[model samples]
Target: MTDSHDASSGAFDPASATIAVVTYNRSGLLTRLLTSISEMDPKPGHVVIVDNASSDDTGEVVESFRDRIGTTIVYRRLETNTGGSGGFSEGVRVAYELGSEWIWLMDDDVEVIGDGLAKMGRWAPRFRSIQGRRYDFDGSEFYWQYRIAERMGIPIPFAPAGFDESGYKPMNSGCFEGMFIHRDIVRQIGLPDPRFFIYWDDQLYGWLASRKTQSVIVDEFVLRRTREIKQWDMGIRHMNASSNAYRYYIMRNRAIMKKYYRALGVYQPVLFGLGTSLTFGKELIRLLFVERTVRGTSNLWRGLRDGRAISRDASFRTMAPLTESVD
Candidate 1:
């Protein structure tokens, strides 16, 4: 749990990896995250904390760890709150420019478990992009389904009763939390699109990575959620009750998502439309029954209106690759 990894140990030196975290005003949560990183076995050599123009004491919180964490702490504060998408976009770019061979992306709300980096690094030889599992606040495994319904553009929760003998499953979608990616993939795919201010940006970024290499979610447990969210317990799984801002973005981002699907030659308007409608109905039910409030419905409707405009807009585009050519 110290900054004592030997460079000659292997290709995945842990020093070659950089941890990029996007944080807002969660100063307390950020502190916990940094503490965990400081304690990680074969800890990353660099940590980039992107502050989304937090009006709170986030800057001071980061400053406190300048020399204490035993790793290079690069703190970059944005001029405005660009949400997770922008924060991560900036963080990953900074890490890449620093010449990091691998970038580990996550939010401030989670803490890395013991030797998480070491476990993730073990697969670097075989996979360029990999993901590790997480434990919820109550000690339950976080839901990280493997596949994506490409045609419908939704995550599919299908997997074997247990992890395969190989201890990982192929994944088309990516979670910003615990997504460990190699620099080659980043150069090929560019950065996470800042256009998606919040929701679904990671999915597209992950899907893009999978297009280039064999992206998979390993069975290794790497993170733990520090906060407990209010969720509606369905018989099968629990649905987290989201904020109005999240509700709005979730509805609005469908248009941006469609642009990517369209570019990939898999845009099925009828199926996508049907899926969106079902999502709308499901959210309405969640807002009414779970949250017991009708306030966020306005955001959902407004999101639909704005989403339509985005879909119709000829100017909106997907993230362009940084490299000259990509497979």
Candidate 2:
């Protein structure tokens, strides 16, 4: 990695960006990600790892890298696992407070390769855009845009067209893994919604950010990671094929976003709600009968009825209690 110096002060200059990685009970995977980040062509100025109350030796893994890595590494161990929303909320808040010009929000499981960060830094001069990795489950390479097309019930295209040597395209949605965001844009729009405990949290931030600035998908940046598998030990299969959490967020957040769109007089909420409900409802039914996970289905119903609410006294430490097992 190329190290630059501050001309006037004769001190090693910190990069303009900071990377915030949120992890829970994935110590091994988190270590790999940290190592990969440390080897980036242009190293980040700061790497903040938020351990979401992991019972394993996650703290030990981070400490191991304290001496080797050049960038400042700040490890904060939460008392509990506050889901993705809370973890991401706290991570981004800290990045902004530290005066980061840009924040790269990432999940622990994802790994970035090649000159991804350096390429992104080169493109930083272009408008403030939210950029994400082109990823697929396991080893398969798939366009992240396929999910958006599927959600909209549109035919999937073979590949993105009109690409130059630099891979760049207009994107409506993005995965949280390796998403680069400008600090100024986040300051104006604020943080991710903490109420969304699991799903759709990143989309909420992306959608809101799009209103004020542009959002893009950088094909060159690849966040290679496996698609989540429904394991028996994972307290809730938030991303499982049988869980209703996906449907619930799609319904409730669609409702919430529709209201915001309507207030801005941009689009009708009825159409958006109808589309989200129909798609998610089909998934919910499959989970109810085929998967037979009763708790997952029940949570869906509750989410739809309750809507999204921010509790006055909510905190990560409180939501995710320090327990031996999530069960």
Candidate 3:
């Protein structure tokens, strides 16, 4: 689908709109993402790539695109791996500082269907309506988060069938990979809490933002990518379950989230903590007794206990770096 706008009138140019992408060691994936951005319509005013201390040649790959892409490509490399929350927080800060009026935050692995920026540009005026695209990993099953929402009968605001045009209503926070946030909203709500480190950071940001502003989903634009699932348990071994890193962050940040929610008079955090404990406990039993990883179970038990602690720091060095090639 194509959108037309008169160049002389500057109708489609939403001043200061930028695309912010966060990457960690996935040089190949970053290259493909840059190519995708190069092909986007109504070209973004700027493109910022936050490289989280990759040991790979990610810097060279980004440098190769200096000429072809229309928007200014600003590459900022961090000194260490700070995970998604920190990377995204820095990316948004950079984009906003670079005068971006609207920021499109995306993961390195995501692929735009076609003219994604132009679609966003044409739709940018409706900044109050934050939109995200449907994501399908492996081009088969939808992401587990979406499936879980469907199972829970939670009304997905951006289903293909369309939703009530009642402006913005509160809904569960979706993944950050395919989401676009208005600059004004981010300015008000601030960046994702860095203490989160990983899981549920997007949820906290979305839920907090929704209280003051309306966020919606754009059903038309779809972002597709191949997700690598490393099986540590049995079902699907995505990043969250494969490494001890996942358990640590899940426990620590969950406690933090519970604290924040309780402070805000939201009672759902207790249920959330219970659900996480039960789910991880089952995984521990399977990995320990069935898979014979007694050490893994011990680590998980510690994680669950520490997760409930209000003052515990979850950061730790694991066996391997919590990253994989995007290809």
Candidate 4:
């Protein structure tokens, strides 16, 4: 699907763009993601891969594709796993250091399905932040994103729908996969908060990006969602029910997000905290009746309690070397 926006003063040059792919222990999946990049119609000029201290052979997998992606590959492995938030933060930082006017951020599990990056490259110059569309495992549009609460920093569910593939619709927030953000926006708002550890990191960053400049979720498919699709209804689901760690982080991060929204100068603490508590209740019910996991239940309870304290003294760290010398 080819969508076009009016050309701005500066036309796009592939050489000015850097693609950041963050991966964990999934070597095979990372290979497919990099392979897809190698096959893009107009490939990125530079690619940066950040490994999240995986026990698997992630380094060898990256080395195997070093010469074939048709770009300069700068691979860096973190000393430990800092979740998706840290990986993307480091990846974007390295891309900026290596000279990138535009940074395209995504995870390694997805595969580029079309000439969408080339299309984004053509349109990105006109806007500060650009988000491409994504499809699920069933080739259905991944519809859980695009609607973010402006005041509360929470993700709200809308009626499932599709978008017209011809316009760049305005958005309050978006996900990391297929996100085309400008260097200036990063300089202005700062990098994705690493303190988030995982959940709410991208949404908070996207919300900040929207505040500073023109950001939109374009109606164009770029990445095909490779992760398992959840059976969710109105955002009511088990929420990684088997994984107590995910429940803990997402629950704990909700309080962190509340503080972030407050700092953003658009927050109503009482209303937002109430709404967040209600959302937490849904996950609790799912954790109990749906998953029947005793451990998840305890994690959920502690998360709710600990999250309050977390909000009381929340802090966000920006990436160092905030401004790149490359223009």
Candidate whose lDDT is highest: 1
Poorest lDDT segment (10 consecutive residues) of candidate 2: 1-10
Model 3 clashing residue pairs (backbone)? 16-101, 230-237
**Model 2: lDDT of residue 124:** 68
List candidate 2 stretches off by more than 4 Å: 1-14, 135-137, 146-166, 226-267, 285-296, 308-327
Tens-place lDDT per residue, model 1, 187-207, is 878989998999989988998
Please count the clashing residue pairs in each candidate, in the order shown.
Answer: 0, 0, 2, 0
Model 3: lDDT of residue 26: 90
* lDDT preference between candidates 1 and 2, better one: 1
Cα error of candidate 3 at position 206, Å:
1.1
Better of 1 and 3 by TM-score: 1
Tell me the tens digit of each residue's lDDT in model 4 across 1-327: 112233223778878889898999999889889888889878788989999998999899888988888888998999999899998888877887776878999998899875867778766767768888788767866764576766555666552355566577777685888788887777767667777787778887888778777678776788887767345343532143346776677678887777666665667877777767766776776666556645566776777788878766645423433655523
What is the RMSD, in Å, between candidate 3 and the native fold over all Cα? 8.7
Cα displacement (angstroms), candidate 1, residue 9, comes to: 14
lDDT of 1 at 195: 86
Q: Is candidate 1 or candidate 2 better by TM-score?
A: 1
Off by over 4 Å in 4: 1-8, 164-166, 229-242, 285-295, 314-321, 325-327
Q: Which ten residues in a row have the lowest lDDT in candidate 4?
A: 1-10
* Segments in model 3 whose C-alpha atoms lie over 4 Å from true places: 1-15, 127-129, 144-170, 230-241, 268-273, 278-295, 311-327
